[model samples]
Target: MSRWRRLWSVPLLVLTLCVAGCAITVPSDPQGTLDRARGGELRAGASASGELVTVDGSDVGGSLAGIVEEFADSIDAKVVWTVGSEEDLVDGLEGGDLDLAIGGMTDATPWSQSVGVTRGYAGVPGARGPVVVLLPMGENAWQAAIEAYLDREVTR
Candidate 1:
């Protein structure tokens, strides 16, 4: 190949590689849950599950509640809690009325088919098994964000 042709090809290859490397690949969120939650209200459903979550009138408190609040703060969002039974929370998640649900849910939760469940994290007081947080189905970005927060918190 000619010298000029070779020099031009090298620059072009480098540019192509740089562009490919810089490309962002965001996770899919069909319902835009994460987008809406950022710098906004995070609709969270809480079920009574012992120390993992406690509901007193409109107030929610417990280990899991603290974790959820911290996670919401990390994203510049405020949590709007809804207290209900496990079934009701799952229904809210399925219907897109809640961004997340936490109530000492475990890996063995039967509502997995209807919602997105985070990977179970251990260490919650009084939890029967690894505890999980549930989210709306197919909100991959939202699920990932919550899971990432849980991963960091659970490890600490």
Candidate 2:
């Protein structure tokens, strides 16, 4: 083989090995729940309009809000709602004003990976219901809680 080809092959083989060795193994239940008392309070933020209202009189647009509420209830945690634009809510979480936030806008954004969202729940209408869950970065406990909650609800 040519010297150039041989050199390229070595790097390619090393890259492939690294990728294979580093592959992440996801849990069977992607949404794993933590104990509520142990889980602590979960502060969630969301964008709202006058047209959308929660059971508590908080403004939360779309059916996504209802699902959020249900999940929060199931988890036995209070959802601290921050009603405003998507940017406002995201800013609130980033600024340490909130623990978690959920919105449709976020589901399509670059931040989705950090937020940890699940799309297209049944009976939500449209192509799929938009639901995004924004969790604190590096908070593995919260991630597990949210993931477990989602797996339970989505399965139902």
Candidate 3:
């Protein structure tokens, strides 16, 4: 193999091994939120600070919006959007009124300390910065499923 390819493999291997070493234990309930989301609704919050989360006619158009739509499609859930200020959205997520919060959240964003943040994704256009979604701060099965989907959809 080329030297460049060989060099990349070690770090990739280490990362894979590290990820494999840690496992999340999902509860065994089939009717839990994670499982129910398969054909249920996803309550989501978004700040009306930018185009990334909007009430633009009939569509919510933005990088994070796209991610939300994709997540909803994956689990057969429809996004129930609540547009408001960042504080309001974050409050909603904390209060169990929102399953996901989408905005221009990024690495080093203050929300990371207050809420559960997904791994940042840099691929999407119109992201003010590397974007991460907010979930409640816990290891619930629902958050795990959404994080897994984002690891594939955004990180990949």
Candidate 4:
């Protein structure tokens, strides 16, 4: 093969390898959100809405709380629910006091820009807009898992 042909072939092979789904795995952090939540408690800070985060402490209804309960059960982790305002929930999640925060969060919520927030979900009744969840910033795995679960549960 000509020198130019060999050089071009090398680049092509490299591109092909990159495109072909090379199994690159970055080990999960032992202390990351998912790991921590699984190993310990799944702390959730939720603001009291009509029923989403009921102050009555009844598990009979509400979208956000129901989903959280399911998640806690799925992971076999205990849930410590803190019913408070949005600021309180966000602060808890940011301070690592909580793994997830749920309220009547909408797309216009200021927290969306600061930390990780879930997509708007229409899982609750009497909601003015779609609800979202506040998460620790850059917690990709945790966010993805939450999103997937919500999609599966809420859609059904």
Candidate 5:
């Protein structure tokens, strides 16, 4: 091949690889545990009080709580519900006292670097459920995964 052709090929290949690598991986059992509220208990913390309570009363575990419970049942993952303020939930998740946390689409930088937030709820501002991921303090892969999952779930 011509030198110019080879040079172009290299750039094209790199571009393709980058694009492919950007694709997020959706977990196999993304909705299974939340779809059914199964036996495997997923300790989830949430922040619901006052007006937010009446608005998202059933969403005490956060908006995703209901869906998580549904999937948990399907996969035998029982979700142990924990109610608390948003700050408390974030603290709990960071402290490892809770497996997962539920909260508004506020700042999720501290808890999990890989945080995902969705918009579009029935009576809320945006999405129904948003998810966030906690990266290794300086990475985005984990966040990508959670975003992909949340993207899929939010649309559903």
Candidate 6:
């Protein structure tokens, strides 16, 4: 190739490579949980945990509940809550029956093996330590959405 042609091709190739590298890719969700819940119901499991999570019959409420509700609303989804024990909530998460779980779970939760936990946020009312929300395992996009919401709304 001619020297001029070779020099122009090299710069074009570098520019192409840089643009490709800088392109944004959506995070993956192995189960398509985020995609499904975007305009539909967000299945959420809740356990009774003091002021962090409260259960009254079929109704779920509390500080964490409010956050979950807001998160759902942000996605144009509604929360369909299932109130249960922690073990049941974990099972729900593992089985993909639930998109996320909340029950005043802390950073030190023992169910980390079966589900994904959000980053702990301190300053939660009535929480003894940093509070976390449980999510379906390997759902990166869903987890990222929730984490971003929490990061914006929750107090450090």
In model 6, which range of ten residues has the least summed lDDT?
A: 21-30
Candidate 1 all-Cα RMSD = 3.7
lDDT per residue as tens, model 4, 9-88: 98998899987756544324334988888856888887777766666663424766788888878877888877777888
lDDT of 1 by residue, 84-145 (tens): 99899999998889999999788888989888888888866666789999989989899889
User: Which 10-residue span in candidate 4 carries the lowest summed lDDT?
Assistant: 22-31
Summarize candidate 6's per-residue lDDT along 1-156 as a digit string, tens digits. Answer: 999998899899999998897754667898999999999999999999999898999999988898899999999999999989999999999998999999878999999988999999886677788999999998999999999998898876
| Alpha-carbon shift of residue 101 in model 5 (angstroms) | 1.4
Error of 3 at 134 (Å): 0.4
lDDT of 5 by residue, 1-156 (tens): 899998799899999998897765443333332323334566666655333232244445334456545545545666676777666766665554555555453333444443333323333223334333222222233334434545555543
**TM-score of every prediction relative to native:** 0.82, 0.55, 0.72, 0.79, 0.45, 0.84
Tell me the number of clashing residue pairs for each predicted model: 0, 3, 0, 0, 37, 0
Reference-based TM-score, model 6: 0.84
Candidate 5 TM-score to native: 0.45
lDDT of each: 0.89, 0.56, 0.74, 0.76, 0.47, 0.91
Deviating ranges (above 4 Å) for candidate 3: 1-32, 49-51, 57-59
The residue pairs that clash in candidate 3, if any, are: none
For candidate 3, write residues 26-116 as lDDT tens digits.
Answer: 3332335566557898888876546666666545667678778898998899888887777888898777777778777777679877777
Best by TM-score: 6
* Model 3: residue 86 alpha-carbon error in angstroms: 1.0
Q: Please identify model 5 stretches exceeding 4 Å from their true place.
A: 1-39, 49-63, 107-149
Q: Candidate 1's error at 142, in angstroms?
A: 0.5
Ten-residue segment with the worst summed lDDT in candidate 2? 25-34
Which window of ten consecutive residues has the lowest lDDT sum in model 3? 24-33
Relative to the true structure, candidate 3 reaches a TM of 0.72
- Model 5 lDDT, residue 67, Cα: 57
